[model samples]
Target: MSLTDTRCKGAKSQEKDYKMSDEKGLYMIVKITGAKWWRFDYSFDGKRKTLSLGTYPDISLKIARERRDEYRRMVATGIDPSANRKASKLVESIEVKDSFKLIALEWLNVKKSEWVSSHYSKIEARLQRDIFPWIGDKSIIEIKPIEILNVLKRIQDRGSLETAHRAKSDISQIFRYAIQTDRAQNNPTIHLGGALKTPKEKHMASIVEPAQVGELLRQIESYEGTFIVRCALQLAPLVFVRPGELRQAQWKDINLETAEWRFKASKTHQDHIVPLSKQAVEILKAIQPYSGHGLYVFPGLRGDDRPMSNNAILSAFRRMGIEKEEMSGHGFRAMARTLLAERLRFPDGIIEHQLAHQVRDVHGRAYNRTSFLNDRKIMMQDWANYLDNLRKGEDVLPDGFTPLHSMQY
Candidate 1:
């Protein structure tokens, strides 16, 4: 007979005794207070072993019989039930493999020290905001080109085509990192080159037309923004260096005695000498009261320690109702370039050298400074005077503006 409650009840009154049921090969051992623990005894590979089956009433006789049958099936299949159960638990606890988010984070961590803090923050923001939500849960190796294209398409749909293009570039870099680590076989982003909408051509530096440039300059002169920025706006076209270089200008870099401003260009990674025009020195002298005490030529509103943001001039342009294509902070360079070459009849080498163009020699490349400094110094003065005339609405002809034929030299 299988275990019956009457049989167990009749015999289990004597506590502290091991009770065996020959009919079912189960041992029902009773503790001193009359609690029953079940044990199953069996022979595996001619060796006898006992497996604990929990306490009685917790694991009922019917449940015990079902568990026994399950073990027997494992034996028939040449599987050890206990070993299989342990392995399954281990597999469940394991994290499977790295997800795209984990891999991307690791990728960022490894390269964090190589990048500036601002660049690090930019990459982190792009990855978290655009890339992570869609592919973070999936493994990096599993991501395909179509999925990446979908992400680009999503950013494009939001009318941020430039951002979409940046996201695509960043994602490609990330996948390339994954490939280097052997986590990914190949870059899926490679196939997605021409799949997305062609990026719209929006000039980073907006330059107004020669005819309208004077009007824009007048608007800048009359702009009623913060005094430091107003002075910066007016000085933009006079110097026409990169926006960062302009804002980060220090008093030490300026030689009022000689009317020359010298600083390192961050983009070209070279020393740049800007021959300050008489007009530029006047503007600087005008703004000296505000920025003279600070480290930067254009200090931020809240502090004297920090330089002004690059957007200060661009925002000023926006307030002047100048579209980005019509005028940007960097567009001043283009304005000076066009007017200097076409209107003022300056040499191409002088203009390019003043602009700090990288010239490749037989050995390598170098930024030539004094290649045409004399003509460039004069050209800068005339350009500054021309801008002043434009701001004053005087009759200034953009007459000497000509395309440079010797850009290669």
Candidate 2:
């Protein structure tokens, strides 16, 4: 039977600790010192476990039974109530300190594997330089929207509107993470969205006209640079991957026989596949004798351990008479996107996958890297053949397509 208040109050201390039984393994032990303690014993996974609910009078019979029922329900569902309680205590301890910096660092630690190293460094630097100095030690729960706005205003005050926007996003991310972890109730950054000034748009300079593209391809052939850089330049137009991804290409990620270069995309964190053309494969084969020993396809001049410097392609562009206003290392992507969309009239959905940009399925079904793999392989070969014809100064425009020479992108 459940212990009533009168009986529990009337129970006296025994010669030694003795039990006053209640229902469902809940009971009270009266010690020789007149101390009363409530406990619950239950079998879990074929092993018995005991839990100290609390002392009587301090806990009261009703509250102790309620806690017992709650914990029993947890165990019935295959949950370990003891381990769950310990985890709750840990979160509570962290919540008590409530340091925004501590929580933000926790968030970053959880997020480090998702972001590329370069992108992760930028985010860490932004938080350290802009947000941490002002409110690092402050309680995240108490940080008002106005306080967040002031921090963003300081970033904007220094003419960094873009950084201000990024800071706002970082703050929101932390607040949401805090909410998931039972720390913050609301996100302050959500209220300050329309308050900050929007930064101006910028697009990378690129040559998209077919004739100009042909001329640019011819100029690439005449490059008198290092053989490593030369091979990189040759493959750039064919693959049209981001400069960073191109330079950081690893040998293990490539399959020459299969004609594919697979890697994790730096921007979207997606498993991206770049189908290599015969020409691209040939360029890699040619450079294999020199750089095949290193980790990166394009190893830095300083050492074989490091990939080529970020500026290597930019410096090579300048030396080849390619001005920033005319074309950049990133411009190769824009060039490919334009020609593929306008000249080839390839489906934007297929092109988007090749560009490693996220696109949802029309039916909202699940899809993976190999989605539309055959079409992309065909497009890759077509693009390679197109570039070769352009470099040869041939007007090999396919009939029934948009005129390529007049339009500018």
Candidate 3:
């Protein structure tokens, strides 16, 4: 018989479990442990199945009846309530996996092998600080271009235009990753081209004129700093390497006998060779007694375990009364690049190769790091001699180094 309210209220637990049936396959299971649960039994496609409504008093008789009717309505329409429930759960799981923050983190893990530790940290930090709080929890497929622009606009409002541009690029990469992985339909950031104001480019201050460069070199020689810094300053112009590369130089990377300094280029992720000149060799030898035992060629003042701060050379420049508009530690590169091409008349390709720049060939292929090794070695020594002459205010037009106007390609 169908159940009623009085019968359910007076229902008692027996020695074993028993069920009180209701209309249309709905029933209540009563257990000896004093627990009661609502259950439904039905058939779909000629196969019988069961669905758990919920617990007894918590689901109550009235609610159980209502839910059972709802399921019966669905079953009458040729639907399987149990299968539909499972499908809904699967969709929820997929949604959680496809959230913007989770997918972005997945993309970051895939890129960790290609990026340096510092580069990875910067990307991670930017996402956490700027992107995560904005739309990180939203589904990647649902994120619109306007939402991303709002995040970038926040950064631009703070006057970090370049950072805003970078943040946009980073978001675009994440969205592209989502598209490739089939989690998203499109990259919202792709349509945002030319949306932000371009940041003004600021060139590193440098002394390009030969006469001014000569004066700058004379002052660097007289820098009143630590002995190791003095030696680094002396070698900076001769080698013209990036300041970070110079300060982080290790004795193991230098072969005194061969006059070569080899290390992986931080920006390009390739092996680079810096041909050491006689003057550069002398400076290295002089500093070896002090920093040779440590991992860094120029160890920090506080401890030998760490390399010198990248600002050491710049600070020395300031102390020498060289204004930021006049020269910087990186200025040595600009100075050498200018004079080498204009005064020394070296080919642009050879000079760019010596700078460890990623120059392309006529066919648009990148030249290898070690390209023109022999010519670079010759150029290194000649550049060193030229610096020596400049320090003494001597004529810079050395023989055998023809001007570009008179040379053939």
Best by lDDT: 2
Q: Name model 3 segments beyond 4 Å from true.
A: 1-97, 103-121, 176-186, 398-409
| CA-lDDT, candidates in order | 0.73, 0.84, 0.83
TM-score per prediction, in order, is: 0.61, 0.71, 0.69
Ranking by lDDT: 2, 3, 1
Pairs clashing within candidate 2: none
- Model 2, span 138-215: residue lDDT tens: 888989999999999999999999999999999999899778766779998889868999899989889898889999
- Best model number under TM-score: 2
Q: Which residue pairs of candidate 3 clash?
A: none
Q: Which of the predicted structures, 1 or 2, would earn the higher TM-score when compared with the native?
A: 2
Angstrom error at residue 340, model 2: 2.0
What does candidate 3 score on TM?
Answer: 0.69
**Candidate 2, position 303, lDDT:** 91
lDDT of 1 by residue, 65-112 (tens): 777777667555444445444433433222535467766665566567
